[model samples]
Every structure is written in C-alpha cells, then in structure tokens.
Target chain A: DAGVTQSPTHLIKTRGQQVTLRCSPKSGHDTVSWYQQALGQGPQFIFQYYEEEERQRGNFPDRFSGHQFPNYSSELNVNALLLGDSALYLCASSRGRFYEQYFGPGTRLTVT
Target chain B: AQTVTQSQPEMSVQEAETVTLSCTYDTSESDYYLFWYKQPPSRQMILVIRQEAYKQQNATENRFSVNFQKAAKSFSLKISDSQLGDAAMYFCAYRRAEIQGAQKLVFGQGTRLTINP
Candidate 1:
C-alpha cells in the first residue's frame, strides 16, 4: 500500500503569492499533520487536521492553514508568503490518535 | 514547551561498522514517545525506530536499535553493520503519548551520517 503521497515535489513562488500543497494520507490513516523544515534545522510543526477539522496547531501564524478532506487527504495553504516561507513542507499521516506518524516525501517550496 | 536536541551535527561510520547518534529531550510529562527518523538525500522522512516511555526495554528493529534512558531523558540510535545507503540526516523526535488530538512532533536539529566504504 502507498504509505503517503504528496504532490508538486518542487515549487517556486514569489513573495505575496499563495501556494497550496497536497498530501494523500497513508492507507487506513485518518489524521494528517503538516511541518516545515529549513536547511540544517529540524521539522517544525505547522498544524494538524483530523476528521475534516483542524484539531491542533503549532506556533505558526495565520498565514499557515490546512484542511483535511473526507478522503483523508489534506492540503497545506500558505498565503501572502514571505521569503522566509522557503522550506521543505512535510506531510504526515497516522491512524487514530497513535503517536507514530508516517511521513510523505515532502514538497520543496522556494520563495523568491 | 517540549524540545528535542541532537548534540552531534554530523557523524561518520565505516561500512560494515556500527555508529550511534545521540539525542536528549526536555519534557515535563512522564508519558511520551521518542522516534528516530532518517531523511536521506531524497528528503523522505523514514521512521527508523521508536521507543515508548513506559517501556523499559529499548526498542529494536533488526539492525536498528535505540538506547533509551528515561531518567536522563536521553534517546540514542545505534545502527549496526552500517552501509553506504544508511547515510542520511537522522532526526530525533518527541510526541506526547496521552494526547488524543493532533499530536505535534518536536524534532532535533538532526545528525548527518556519512558512511565511508
């Protein structure tokens, strides 16, 4: 089974533009979470979506938002992106409320 | 706030040898989970191994094992018979085990492993 899938392996956008990254959850997983990783740094939590609703969020600002679809897929949307928005966006999926999460290949976003 | 730290920014291992990556975490809660994720050049986050707080026995998966010290709040990963393919940036992560909602994983800066043949 496909563990997890993310679209647009790589993207380039200018400042102030909006971008949407997609994630398909692993088979049998219902919860989806998003994270941002900068070079030489660890992945930082952005937010999480479950049952089509946002359940928890990290310290990120309002510019970062996400949605979970009925199919268990999710989308991470960054609006009015800043140059600092350039990072590898990671998507992870888990079953129920388990602590272990399976991650995707991640989408690399480059803000110019 | 919960935080994970990987003191070693880089590590090297000779092929067929073993290497261990260090990790330390700060958390107020007693019950939690720690994980080792391998991110190769491909940039995919692959779960290497995991340890549950309540379990005293260190978690092991074949050639991958973890050294977990609950009292010291430390978790280390040991890779046996290392191969060139094992080279990657290894990240130590933490998550609250009791949370039923969206649990966020706090990750360490990561240690880049280089396997020399």
Candidate 2:
C-alpha cells in the first residue's frame, strides 16, 4: 500500500512570507499530524487534525495552523515565516488516536 | 507532559557489529508507548520498533530491538549486524496512550549513528 506522501520535497521562502505544505496520509489512515525537525534535532510536534478539525496542538504559536480533509489529506500553513522556520516539515498519519503513525518523507523548508 | 532524552549526540560502529543507542524519558503516565525511528540521509522517518508500556517483555523487530525499562524510564534501541544502510539519525520517541488528536509524539534530541565499513 502507498504510504504517507508529502508535496514539494523542498522549499525556499523569505521572511514574513507564508507557505503551505501538503500531505496525503497512508491509505486507510484517518488522522494526520504535523511536526518540525530543526537541524541537529528531533521533530517537535506542531499540531494534529482529525475529522477536519484540530483536536490538539503543541507549543507552536497561532502562526502555525493545519487542516485535515475528509479523505485524510492534510495541509500545514505557516504565516509570517521567520528564518527560524527553516526546518524539515514532517507529516505522519495514523488510523486513529491510539495507533502507530506512519510518516512521509519530510519537506525541507529553507527560510531565507 | 512528557520529555524524551537521547544523551548520545553521535556514535560510530563498524559494519557487522552491534550498536546500542540510549534513551531516557520522564513520564508519570503508566499507559503509554515508546518508539524508535530511523531517519536516513533521504530524510524519511522509518519506524524501527515500538513497545507498549504495559507490555513487560522487551520488543524485538528482526535486527532491531528495544530494552524497555518501565520503572527506570529508560528505553534503548539495539541494532545487531549493522550495515552501511543503518547509518542514520536514530530517534527515541514517546506517545501517550490517551488518544487526543492522533496522539502527539514527544521526541528526543536524536542520536546520529554512523556505520563504518
């Protein structure tokens, strides 16, 4: 079966600009979660979406938002991006709230 | 809230040898999950192995296994007969059994593994 897939393997954005990253969850999965992995660091949870609504979020600010479609695809939108926003964006999918998540090849965002 | 820690920033092992990466987490929640993920140069996060907190037996997945110490809050990954393909950043992660928004994963700083041939 096709696993989690993400769009734009890499990206380049300037400060204050906005960017949107897309993800198609693994087949048969229903929930999507976003994470940010900075250089030399493990990923930090950004937020998670289920039933097309956000259910929980991490320490990220309002600038970081996400959406989950009925088909289980997801979009992570970061507004007013800063250089610190430069990191690898990862998308993970799970069948439900208490299942192991499958991850996609991250999109490397380079904020210039 | 939970926190994961990987004290080893980097490690090197010769091919065909065995390497153990250490991890320790702090959590009061008795029911949870522990995981080890491998991120190769391609940047794809691959689930290496998983262990349920309630399970007393240590988890083993082929060449990859975990030493899960529930009371000590320590979970370590062991890779046997390491190959060049095993060179990657290994991450130790923790997830609460409580289902909330897909269950957030708290990851450690990560341990970079280098396999020398």
Sorted into a CAPRI-style docking class, model 2 comes out as: high
lDDT tens digits by residue: candidate 1, B1-117: 998999999999899999999999999998998999999999999999988899999999999999999999999999999989999999999999775666789999999999999
- Clash totals, every prediction: 0, 0
Regions more than 4 Å wrong, model 1: none
Fnat of every candidate, listed in order: 0.91, 0.91
Tens digits of per-residue lDDT, candidate 2, A5-110, equal 9999999999999999999999999989999999999999999888898988899999998888878899999999999999999999998867889999999999
- In the order shown, the candidates' DockQ scores are 0.83, 0.81
Location of the lowest summed lDDT over 10 successive residues in candidate 2 chain B: B95-104
- Model 2 TM-score, all chains together: 0.97
* CAPRI band for model 1: high
Error of 1 at B32 (Å): 0.7
Measured over all alpha carbons after superposition, the RMSD of each candidate to the real structure, in angstroms, is 0.9, 1.0
Model 1 alpha-carbon miss at residue A76, Å: 0.8
TM-score between candidate 1 and the true structure: 0.98
